[model samples]
Target: MTSPQLENHLPFLRKTGGAWELIVDNKPYLILGAELHNSSMSSARHMESVWGKLRAMNINTVLGNVTWEDIERDEGVFDFTELDRVLVAARSSGLRMILLWFGSFKNGSSSYVPGWVKTNTRRFPRAQIRDEHGSLTLSDSISIFHSECVMADIKAFTELQRHLANFDRQRTVLMVQVQNEVGLLGDSRDRSLQAKKQFNSAVPNDLVRFLSSQFNNLQEDAKEKLGRFQDTLSLCHPSDQRSWEDWFGSSVYTDELFMAYHYATYVESIAAAGKRAYDIPLFTNAWLPKPAVGGGLGNLIAAGGALPGSYPSGGPISNVIDIWHWLAPSLDFVAPDIYDADYTATCDTYKRGGRPLFIPEQRRDAHGARRLWEAIGSHLALGACPFGVDSLEPESFAYTAQYKLLGSLETLILRSRQDSKRTFGFYFDEFEGQQADKGPPIGVSFKEFDLLISRAFVFGRPSPGCGMIIEIHVGRYLIIGDGFKVEFKSRSATSTFTGILRAEEKSVQNTVTGALRTERVLNGDETRSGKWVNMPSENPDYGDGFIPLLTPAGTRIVEAQVYSIDE
Candidate 1:
């Protein structure tokens, strides 16, 4: 059967179908994936071994990078070579990829720009910031115009998209990140003399016209679209050219508007060019650290400037959030790179756009990993990824083959809806954390299991902890964080079902080493002795990290009182 047009399928993420509960398809298929970086660079030689490990983990999609510096090597000279190698490796490995454009900005750095651009300030200027030294710092690449951001750059990015589409026609390379962690820093706005000149001038007309049609109440529309309007129609009682505060409401308006507009233009250009190459979904990811401290003033600048009302706001409520949604017709969706505290709240922030929610990056916590699954089920997230896939230490609890499977199954996670088992979560805060987020708490989903999240005693906390007493009553709970303990009861999934008498184990391993092994632990009195080590011997893959697989369709696991691993 022919695939749906890339345009048509983009909205599928927000729509729900089927019986048990909120669904994205006739069945649920939430994403569960891990990210591997610093492990795999923009090189072919590195891909093979790295991917073999990911495959072992059952990880499907990869949030890979096709850096701008690598692509734009010299003035007018573009290289698709590095990008080519990565794509070939990913295709061969059956790994879908999210290509992050390490362009003009990456984690607030001009470091990614080619040597030529960095050296020649004359051709491609910088965002002029007044450093403490009284001298100005050429910061904020967003405001800097370039000799390199040519049709050539756009065309190169476009061609690269087509090249991947040739091999990933089956939809393996699910999305392409327009740029890596695009943000502004230091000053709330750019210090570019050129940017300043433009800001002082009248707002653009095209932008104004666009906002008029999308929003009601000119004032409401003006607030959402703020800062950058290109010749807006003078409807609201003749145009007096609204004042600075009247125009955008916040101090940000201009800078955010510029960043959003710039990003939109790039994404739109790439998307348009790529469609000429092949047809598949394309998405962008944001680096959302703390809306403030983590990403710098850039978050305010970019998000504030956005005409968010332009995109497909799916559920709950809506408002303009970022420039990503408005600028590009070719771009399918915008996502977030979630890190730090407040998983549910952060996800909710993106949900305001009401577009499909996907966490392109996340922490590699065991408890967090499980929460990711819940996130996919609850928030309708397309997938999730953890940072630094390869360098994890041997003792790090985050390092495990079990997670690879979580990553692999991510693409099809939306499929495992009510048919999948729903679990529980725990925490300990009086009227905060889980305690305050009453009701289903917006993270995990199990159809009827509108998960009751509250601040209980943290999992590994001791006896005197009031929140520690009542553990999740479910037999299964996915773990992500480190240093947590749970002592309690769960309906014996095995004991309740007849002919389910078996203790299963499987070891997930590295394809090359074959020597790698996964070991399950014994907890509580379940081990049957002073022996904390002699639990039942089950080798799912003989200690490999993949799921219930000593055999196929494996559901065989002997029930135990508790599970704890001293990683």
Candidate 2:
């Protein structure tokens, strides 16, 4: 089949060695994005009011939902009125978009399906899950086993893509998420008659062959989870067949694996159909597992249930991520909708085996804002989108300052990402008097210098700070953000000491060119007389004994170079 022709430039992903870049207009583009509330994009007037706020906050891209129910209220009939309005408004605001297709399964519920599909339960069966009692009850989740359900979703999504290609010839819509947090809810696996019948039947020969071939390449954790399946595959003769329970044992993990296979296959079909229609980059997002207390998996917090039904079963979490990757070929990547999870660990897990990392959703708070530096700088992530951006005013949003700094330095940051080792990002969280000694100081070595970064020194208490250090050239580095300090030492065996040669604060002189113009030369107090370079937070606590009541936050970008000396 031939792909649809895109008239103007289309956004695509490119891998440069270890790092991946999002290319827009044939240039490396950093997506400093903000996701609107789920229901906000339905009204064009409401969207018009918030576009200015999003622009003021320095958001280059916006992530919003485009539900199937809204677009296809009647069977075979599709409406693009709201979608067109959103695309036009985003273009007017000079912003790009990633539309989340809230179809088939939305957060483990089929509530977003069209009324016709929802009303006809007999034609399109719902997943059955165990209620509080032992008896089974129908859940709101649509059954993946049914052909009618898959076909309906594929039709709606294909039409959406066709319409996008026609209306958005400018390529304002950069990417599309096939479904929203798709998984089996309220049960580890669907308990309906159709699901049970399939579960008891022989495991699909395609999946069995895939598992047998890719066993060695799968992640260690994945191997351990599917060890039983491997054994079953090895023992079973060509004439013999094994069911899901027979292969993986009757555990919750097995149930999760079964659901993941179906979900991935279903999403793959929809994504493949959409690609045939328009061929824009397509992906899906997962509701990640919350932090586990220890290896034993009991003291997990937030919705941190390790069992299949505890969280959304069959979502593309780390445990089942490899399965989705093997099955969902059409999906460009899988993203995490991070809220209360451990940010660094989650990002690291998602980018396993050279996968592209793009955090589509995260908490919209100061804590979340501080973590973006690590995600983008250290992980080489394409972008980070904090959720519910439209609800907050530009002045109140925690990411406003950080986004502005990143927006201005987009070019420089993209350049630095190529050499992953030379660049390091860090964040110093607020010291709440008790948990002061949590994270250890970060130490890095480059050339003959040892760089030590820790929380900026404060008299009374330390406030939150976040930033990245990019070594533009040998011994020369560009540092951006607030609330951190860099201390340098000599790594040379001969040199006695290493000291900063020059540290200058920089500002963007030309926004279009991303040219950095030095605003002030730092030496005496700012550098503490070559001791360290401090980019203090917006409000630093200098203590009551000091003359100036409170030192305002020093959220400035700086450049520094160092030289070693032997006495």
Going through the candidates in the order shown, the clash numbers are 61, 2
Which candidate has the top score in lDDT? Answer: 2
Candidate 1 lDDT by residue in tens digits, 284-403: 666443323332223343232222211111101113344456666675666666665367776666655455667777777654554564455456566667876655542463425444
- For model 1 the local lDDT of residue 227 reads 30
Off by over 4 Å in 1: 1-30, 72-82, 133-135, 140-150, 167-172, 206-246, 289-323, 393-413, 416-567
The lDDT for every candidate, in the order shown, is 0.47, 0.84
lDDT of 2 by residue, 1-567 (tens): 321222347777777768888878777889999899889998888898999999999899999999999999999988899889989999988999999999998887888999999999999999998865668888888999899999999999999999998899778999999999888767789999999999999888787777778888776767888888777767775335888888888888888989999999999999999998887789999976554522222222235455666577898988788889989989999999888787888888889888899999987999899999998878888888899989899999999988998988888888776555477777877656577465567898776678898777677677777888888777787888887788998887888878889998888887667788887898877788888888777777777557543335443789999988876
TM-score of 1: 0.63
Error of 2 at 117 (Å): 0.2
In model 2, the clashing pairs are 537-553, 538-553
